[model samples]
Target: MKRYAIIVAGGKGERMSSNLPKQFIQLRGIPLLMHTIKVFYDYDSLIQLIIVLPANQISLWKKLCNEHNFTIPHEIVQGGETRFASVKNGLVAIKEKCIIAVHDGVRPLVNRQTLENCFSTAEHYGTAVPVYAIVDSLRKTENNTNFAVERNQYCIVQTPQVFQSSILKIAYNQTYEERFTDDATVVESLGIELNLVEGNRDNIKVTTPPDLKIAEVLLSEREAIIS
Candidate 1:
């Protein structure tokens, strides 16, 4: 079975307080997006990769890939304005009848075990998602109004969301509202059954300056132990 990884890296770093996209930000001297890709590569070399970047920033991505001596032969697709559109673009690049995993490029800490689990589970089930059960009390706030909710009912969604390539492509092809938060939501729209597995808490999606600091600390500790 052919496995594909779509790394969506097109978000502008508005919250990151940088002119460049958040995925392009440096973490421990290397681009954060590169670290995300390396996780997939390390997990399984046989997995094919499709990276989505902002249309105007494709040139910059190519240059970085070349300069960093990136050896993976992955395809690059032009990203859309929203995350859903960017993933849809990637779905189009893949051929039919395979396994495909969509991942946020800013999440560099997805462990190899998680990738393996997602892919393994997805092989049998049409859709598989990594999710963590919420452990904290939850409340909904809108315009400073707070509403209480049952924490037991919620789970925090994480990525490397895996599905059968054919099914996923068909799901993405269906038009929907901008409310599609993730690939699982798209699959849910098609009335498909989704399988869930445990996700590591360490698998974080970087979006702000504080996230960068946390990632730096993680990388430093890892390297110190390795050396």
Candidate 2:
């Protein structure tokens, strides 16, 4: 079956306090986004990879590709103003009916097993979202007051959210809304139940300086194991 990944990376790195977008920032001497793309390719070389980037950053991305001698083939699409719009724009490039995995470009640590599981589950169930069990205490804040809630009732959603291409296309046809935080939410808006798959806690999105440092440590640990 044909496979594709839409890696959304339009953030401006405001949280990272960097001139370059967080995706373009170096992690273990390689661009964070490149590591993300590589993992998908490593899982299935035949999978088509499409990266959604801010309109202004496309040129810089290409330059980085050349500078890094990154030759893995992938398509680049300009992102829209909102993440919902950006994902919709990425969907424009997909033309076949197959498994499509929508992932965060900064989340480069998703393991091979997790990718395979998501795709396999999505292939059978039409939609699958990776989630980690919430271990922290839960709280509800109301009018400056907080109340305890059941942590077991909630899970931390992560990506490589996979779905059948046709299902995803149908979900994206609806008008964009501010409340649509993730692709799963959009699909749920259509009354479709999403399949949940286990995700790794290590699959962190590099959004801040601290996240970068954490990723560096993780990468170093992985390399140590390999060598």
Candidate 3:
């Protein structure tokens, strides 16, 4: 089946304490988004890559691509006010039947194996998302109160959430809602169960400065291993 990957990056870098958007921050001398695009390109050169960025940031991204001499082919879509809307915009570029994987542009560490597992599972199950078991103790807080909860009952959900285009398009067609935290939630609202596959813990979404440092270390280690 044909494959499509929609990479959503609308971060304003508020949490990262930077004026530049987090996705455009430098990682190992290249803009972070380029690394993300390369990962999907490596996974399947024929896979259609769509990057959804804020409308105002599109020109900056193109300039960065030219400055870095980044040549991997991808289509750019202007993002919306919300992640849901951004993803929906990215979906607009797809008009054919194929598998679709919605991913976070900041999560460049997602291994190829995880991508393969997600796309392969979604190819058969109609939906698939990667998840990693939580290692920290759990807590629940409400009304200015907090208490420990069972940690074993939950896991951290990661992206590259793959789904059949038919279901994804249908899920995105509904009006946006505050309760729709992620693509999986959007699909689940329609009573569609999502298949979860094991995800690599290193596939962390870069948000803060410390997160960027961690990504640099992880990327260096990966290069060391590869070389």
Candidate 4:
């Protein structure tokens, strides 16, 4: 089946304290979003890439691509007011039934193995969501009281949330709701159970300045391994 990735990168960078969107910020010597796109391209040259950006930022993104000489062919779609809307916009651009991976463009460190696993699992199960086990203590706050909970009961959800295109398309047809935080949530609302897969710890969504530093370190470590 054909593979497609809808990379949602509509951040305005207010958290990163930068004028540019977080995805446009330089990770090492390249834009973070470029690193994400290149990795998926490297994974499978046949995989169709669709980038979703804020309507006003599309021109800036194009200019950045020209300046960087980044010529990997991909379609750019305008994002919507909310992430749910943004994803729905992306789903509209897909006309064929295939495997689709909805990913955060800021997550530049999604390893090849994780990508392969998600797609392969989704192909079989109709939906796959990458998650990492929570290793820290957890708590539940109610009113002014706090109670301890089992950390193992919760998992950290990561993206490249892959699903059959038809399932995702059908899921997006529901009226937008505030609780639809992620693609998995949207699909789950349809009574579809999600298949979970292991996610690499390095697969982080870069949002703040500290996240940028962590990504730089992670990239350097990976390069060291390659060298």
- Judging by lDDT against the true structure, name the best candidate: 3
Give the count of colliding residue pairs in each prediction.
Answer: 0, 0, 0, 0
| Better model by lDDT: candidate 1 vs candidate 2 | 2
Clashing pairs in 1: none
Off by over 4 Å in 2: none
Model 4 clash tally? 0
Expressed as tens digits, the lDDT of each residue in 30-57 for candidate 3 is: 9898999999999899999999999899
| Model 3 spans with C-alpha error above 4 angstroms | none
Model 1 clashing-pair count = 0
Worst 10 residues of 4 by lDDT: 88-97
- lDDT (10s digit) by residue, model 1, range 1-227: 88999999887899999998899888987789999998899788888999998889999998987888877778999998788889998988887679999999999988877888899999987778998888888999999799989998888899999999878988888886777999999998988999998887778899999999988887777668759
Which ranking of candidates, highest lDDT first? Answer: 3, 4, 2, 1
What is the lDDT, from 0 to 100, of the residue 114 in candidate 3?
97
Q: Where in model 4 is the C-alpha error above 4 Å?
A: none
Whole-model lDDT, candidate 4?
A: 0.95
lDDT of 4 by residue, 199-223 (tens): 8989999999999999999999988
Candidate 2: tens digits of C-alpha lDDT, residues 113-185: 8898899999998999999998889899999999999999899999999999889999999999888999999
Task: Give residue 129's lDDT in candidate 2 (0 to 100).
Answer: 95
TM-score of each: 0.93, 0.98, 0.98, 0.98
By the TM-score metric, which is better: model 1 or model 2? Answer: 2
lDDT for model 3 comes to: 0.96
